[model samples]
Target chain A: MDNIAGHKSSLTWAVHISVALLVLLWLLPTLGLLVSSFRTADQIAGSGWWAAPFPQEESLQLRTAGPDEMTQDGDLYVIEGNLLEQNGAGDLDISAWGTSARDVSAYAPGKTAEMRGGETMTLEEDGTYRLTSAEAFEGRGERVFVSATVPPEFTLDNYERILFSDDSREGMAKAFFNTLTVTIPATIIPILIAAFAAYALAWMDFPGRALLVAAVVALLVVPLQLALIPLLRLHLSIGIGKGYMGVWLAHTAFGMPLAVYLLRNYMVGLPKDIIENAKVDGATDFQIFTRIVLPLSFPALASFAIFQFLWTWNDLLVALVFLIDASGQTTVMTRQIVELLGTRGGNWEILATAAFVSISVPLVVFFAMQRYLVRGLLAGSVK
Target chain B: MNPALQGVIIVVLAVAVCVGYFWSSNQILDRVIFPAKGEKAGQNINRANMVRPWLFLFPALLVLGVYLAYPVVETLRLSLTQRVGSGYEFVGFDNYVQMWNEPKFREALLNNMLWLVVVPAASTAFGLLAAQLTDRIGWGAVAKSLIFMPMAISFVGAAVIWKLVYDARPLGQDQIGILNAIYLGLGGDAPQTWLTIPFWNNFFLMAVLVWIQTGFAMVILSAALRGIPEETVEAAIVDGAGPLRVFFQIKVPQIMGTILVVWTTITVIVLKIFDIVYAMTNGQFETQVLANYMYDKLFRANDWGVGSAGAMVIMLLVTPILVWNVYNARKEMR
Candidate 1:
């Protein structure tokens, strides 16, 4: 296609560059969160995540030994300590030092700066400092300003806190399991139910089959929002009120339309001769369906399973209304993340970690079974 | 009982029951009700086959009716009635009137209309650009996958991701958010809070949807582009058409049907969008959409009448696409 008439070589480079920029634009946001999740709170607050891999230059305030720690030796009051050790500035190399905020890096490291009252302070490259005064030290510690190069640091503490800690308020471990509980059943149940219905619509001789298929297609676009109040009312009137069972049932019901639509479309495309041959052998419709159509529709079934798994796993609305009780033990990952977003809005470490935890599973499933997912999308849409 | 154990038990029992029903019903239908060895086996077999389809369809139909179909009518009814204590009172159109009078509901409706127009169009356009460009390049698949990666992230997750992008600090402090960083880098005076600004914030929220959905549009449209026959494009090039002309005139016109399908599908998704707005702004600074507005009425305000009315409005917006899809399906079936 590129070799076709009127295709310019420069335009090819333009296309490549445009696509690169677009992909970068698309990836940067999620990458920011991913990078942030690995950073400490102070590190995240200090600099942007894009600068995480490089050493950062920052101006920090340091204090010398207090007057109480000074001693008079040969008519000179002397104070000594390591500025980095006192400030807990781990792994930072001081390039310059100063006595005032007006010029934070006025003097190089290892240089001596003369102070008022005949005081002299000398700071070294390794953060060791000495202060000498003719008179005895009379006040609190002297403030020293330093500009240091801090090495890039990363930690897994955010994940450990969000996942392994006993702090239930921000932990995603419980919601992770709850989402699995909702997803597995909701995904599996709909497949068998829809498969049978799809087989009937595809193979079996029945009146109103086309109308039923059309109804399923129409039901495809009905917003699940409408189901919230009515279904909640029904669930409350019955024994099941906002628990795993209600969510699974709601998801299964909601998923039935697409499950049936995709599977029916796939099953209808099966060779007619196969069903006819099975019938010639005196096999019942049930036998033909179970033995022939079911095995043949594996791709379609897998596609819908992926679809339903991703949908139910990523869903917040269904789980919010149907599953979670006031006890909140039944909360799923999406809901938990939303809660964290509200309460921990400014805490990027917790928010990024929580968001990543919730998004990781579906991403794994998506990439692994992308073929089936794409197949499902093409079949479900573009009909 | 522990919910996890209960979940396991329910899964096993549900699968067992489904298998058990299908096996026994088929057995009863063939062996007892319509025994092929009997003198009247022919008529009995005919009766059995007719009943078997409904048996297969019963569970799915039951669920679809009780869950999806019933809700539309029930929500409409609930919208008309006022919740009087535990029961409901018939107050026809009062909820709609109340929703009409409310400022928030009007804001939500207008925002939804804006979303309905902007998200689909922008997504489709970007998706088309991605599809056409990617198809011409060697490493296009990787780029396409990266763009499509956002489809897997949940809307709540996306809201968090974009929130960081739009984050703002005070004038003196460093800007961590990319949007603010870029703004300040481009000679802007101060870092702006992207989500809090009125009117424009809606576009910020819609950007998240567009980001997530463009990959979807790209995948479908790419497939459609590949499906387009080679001869038409070749003929267009032979007729002195440039690459751009060949694309817009020849390729796009051919995939118009697919483009429309993608548009309507995304339009349906945008109409029902809740989590992005709910998580990002929660309707603050006039970013309320219908789903979030409905959620506010039902849960926060505890007004069932107005909430149900809001649900009806969403349902009403979806009705045209529903009718269009059903009509197309019926047409294809014939």
Candidate 2:
């Protein structure tokens, strides 16, 4: 008995440790991007995001105040200031300093380096500096290379540039609104259409109802890839062309199968006695559907709404074919991010910030109403 | 006009129109067309009930027919015909012959097969593992939520997130990309540009999907696992089965049906995957999947014949699942 109990306790510990490891592995990639979005471009280039919270030692090249700032003191020309303080490193602790890039930390902080022209320079760990020349300093300020330990810094500048800047190439503000334009109508219209249809399929005794239900089931797995060219041709010929109306219609059509299927399934499960009672009360089919059936199917309605909203918001292929024009005026967030990936592939800061802005809205919806989303998935898939 | 303003106007107008249609149509039917008054009131009520379902079903059926059902037939016809000057000519399998001859098409076919196998399997395994393990611990809901969070992110958004992980820098500078950082830390001689590597880059792209989908599988599978009857597990324990034995031998067998359902659903998703590959590699470096390849042929190459042919190929791959789902649904209905 003791042996069995001992083994059980050990297995419990194993489960905890394994779950922790799995969660971390799953989260690390997204966490990296989330952390990277807040970091400066230089910090991202200098180290990994895992090392973001702690102070990091970095090498910086700074020029002293130009020769115009040099002063005459007791037959020596001198420049006095803090090298780190001058360069936004006021809080940094300098470990070493050098004049050449090859060996950035040749001398300890607070030590003086003898110059070629009978000049000497001293930099202290506290970031203060002194440059003494027997002759007057000339030309640009002397270049000082210093290795300093910098405190962890986070910035919202990347978000500012990506979201607010009017620069056409990097901005996502336009695309964000475009996505909203596509998603809202695309989501609401379908539920309205599908709810009525679903009510009929569930309650109304009509011929070929079984066939129609099967058709919806079959359409559920039909890849929307098949719809692209034909729909585009139809849209162009019908004068809707490639714009918001075309995309909205296409989404509504494509989303109809799932919307109808989920809602019908949920509505079918409603108590049959209520509809019979309503019928006995002389309420017509339309009245029962509008009054009782619609309200009772709220959970199903909410689930399908969340699904359609997320799918439309995240979609790229449909928009690519039906919405965006050559003018690029109707570009959505997903399309904009893809464009950024091609144009600014190496700029992690812009990419991260842009991706996050696009992802944040759906994330909010997902977290706030996760129950409905999960319920929808279960009904949509498990059946 | 501002698109946002246009959106608001459209929403209000759309809601008003829908409400008006349902309300007015129902009113007209009950009051005028088939008034529930006079000597023939019973007959009129029966007639209105008979016609009302069709009225409710009209818009949905019209949209479905034009948008989805017609597209399948039209795309198939377009595949067989060549676009010549402003019109189409029936070329009879020429597009398929040409697509078969193209090496890029073959590469895409092979890569899609690989994606179909790897993504669903990996996602299901990870999801099941997460589902089982998380179910056993305290604070599991938080862990499940974090894992499930990626499903909310769009494919393009996920592409950017993974691109940051797979980022490459020169050897001497500090490596910011997590993958390269780990590779170098483990004594790799130089940082590898993961997405540029030819054959293996496909796996790198598939990782994005697996990351996004595992949460979905975990959510569904976790529910299935919880739904398992506790007495069966207790029975296995009383029989002296170990934890691993109980999991594989007892619990998994019961949930096999749910697992298969999860698998096929993901398989359907995998077959139509586009945004991830389009954003990450754009079918470059032999990473072409069928959907992206079709996009390339249709938009970039301007050859609608081959593009529609490629679309048909996707449809063909999906047909078996569609049939199976319809069959299962019909069976359950019966």
lDDT of 1 at B304: 88
| Alpha-carbon runs more than 4 Å astray in model 2 | A1-6, A73-76, A100-103, A106-121, A132-139, B36-40
What is candidate 2's lDDT per residue for B4-27, written digit by digit as tens?
888888888888988788888888
iRMSD, model 2, in Å: 1.6
Clashing pairs in 1: none
| Each model's lDDT | 0.91, 0.92
Residue pairs clashing in model 2 are: none
Q: Each model's DockQ?
A: 0.83, 0.75
What is the alpha-carbon interface RMSD for each candidate? 0.9, 1.6
Q: TM-scores of the first chain across all predictions?
A: 0.88, 0.93
lDDT of 2 by residue, A114-229 (tens): 97889899999888889999887788898988888878899999999999999978999989889999999999999999999999899998789999999999999999999998
TM-score of each: 0.95, 0.96
What's the interface RMS deviation of candidate 1?
0.9
What's the distance in Å from true for residue A115, model 1? 10
Q: Residue-pair clashes per candidate, as listed? A: 0, 0
